[model samples]
Target: MAGDLVLLTGSTGFLGYIILTELLKHGYRVRAAVRSQTKAKRVLAGPSIKALAPTDEQLSFVTVPDMTAPGAYDDAVQGVTYIIHSASPIPSFGDGEPPAQDQLEESLVKQALKGALGMLESAHAKAGGSVRRVVMTSSTVAVVPFEVYMGQGTEPDRVWTSEDRIPVAPGPYGFEFQAYSAGKAAVLNASEEFVRTRGTAFDIVSITPSWIFGRDELVTDAGGMRAGSTNSVLLGVVLGVKNDAPYGGNAVYGPDVAKAHVLSLDPVVKGNQSFVLNSMMDWEDAIAIAKKYYPDAFAAGKLREDGKQPTMALKWDASKAKRQLGLELAPFDTMVKEVVGQYLELLAAEEGSK
Candidate 1:
């Protein structure tokens, strides 16, 4: 995507900030479409971000005018060769049980898709043609459901992937991972349909990420909660780091996740391209990294004493990403440290504000 001016929809988010920083690091000029240009300024102040923009000469910011309206990106679609649709709803640590937490309000998967589809429409209406590609931010929760994994073979209450392994309107129970992944799966399904029948000229790809932990440019909201901030599993451990909990979830570095998004958008999906970043990891790895860099922030919590063995196929086939993106993920030690360090920084900042 070099020499290309990409339009980013969620430039003020954690992953968005990292993605923008990465894009600018690679010399890709950006048009950050966010809700508040004012808040966008603070987000760009992160050391990592400031280093990318250097000066706001080529960088541009625009308040996404009516993203849910008829054609939000219609006028904003000028000169942008690529679209990085990275905005989505995420929850702070342990904040739960709200109707919004269901991804309808926070994730806004459907509305975002509508906006994305509208962009394709808006792009086609452009004088030249539709945007060349639309890169979406999907969650790993979409790839596999937690209930299925948790049930495995023993928890008779477990469910399994269906023939299509896709979600339907009357789909499986909406557990946390299931619902989140289901939302992403729905968007990808929609994207594929739109591209195949309506806008073949526009390429689309989905980058699914797991528990993302890293430094953030987006400040804590007025409520003091932010996506990727209040991780229940981590918090449970952080709350219980004093104890040992055998925990293993697909945790990756934020920067690596951002890099995966860029590489996935390289117009190579039909070419068997993949957008998955971060290989699977187990509890000990997270514990070691947490202990080294954030002894106070992380903990080795006491998990189900199922011998701490990998419950199921806790791996994802990221071979395509490696082959296509040629990306080398940061080491577990480095990635975990960066994530824990960020959590601590967030904790300190929150305490100071109080």
Candidate 2:
């Protein structure tokens, strides 16, 4: 179909904005479902989006009421032939649920699945013989445990992708990553059940990626901007987290996370093409790249000039994504260096103000 009318949930979100920008590049007719149109416009006006010159009408906005409520996307999913559901919770604090014990089991995860089922049902009804596919954003946490680290001999490349689906962590890392992982796992599992039970209205596929790091798409309001500044905090944490920094997490770039969604959206990739983006690294690897490419800044921070601290290797595999989705990832150094440069500039401005 020429210019597929695509429906994107969580359009106002960080990864959502990147997906919007990338989709716009292909001129895919997109409808971004936002909680508030006015707030969305402000986000669109931000540096990340303003550069794209998104047409108001082309970039249509819809009100996504409450995610917890099912059928929230009923009307929005009406005519959209392609659906990219990149909406999920990334915990800032620990999982707020009473028991971290209960959360690690599968509380939040089942919730997302419930939402996914609602969307799938809506899409099944509205396919109008046109709905081709549904692409969701799963996380690298879905691939396995946090122990899949580096080994002996040559650097055995292993990262999150579509093919692997075994738990590799020590099992019970915590409810935070667990909820996120289990939630994605629920959706993927639910999607499978959907196809098995519903008989393929549109093949369901998902992209499991790592922690996304990039500039905020829209500043939103001052409050929203402040909240969105998590982007910066996460980036800066690397400079200061030092040895005590938490490093056993999966990571990926915002653009790649968005692209993995797009690749899944393309008619070329379907149920057979589901995968994850696991181009993540240990804190040491993360720091090494920072120090190697940005010696001056690294020296300024005085963060491990000796060497990177040791970290557990996480397991990830991306062959399917490479072979099928055909994603050529940018170097890890480039991605980290770019963000570091942005951080350095921000620091300089902060110092100047003082």
Best-fitting candidate, scored by TM-score: 2
lDDT of 1 by residue, 53-158 (tens): 4566567887875676676777678878888888765433445453444444334445556666676667666626646777887766555544445544333333
Give the per-residue lDDT of model 2 (tens digit) for 68-143.
5766777888778888887765554311334366555444565666677777787887557567788877765565
Off by over 4 Å in 2: 93-107, 145-161, 166-174, 219-237, 242-250, 298-310
Candidate 2, run of 10 with poorest lDDT: 146-155
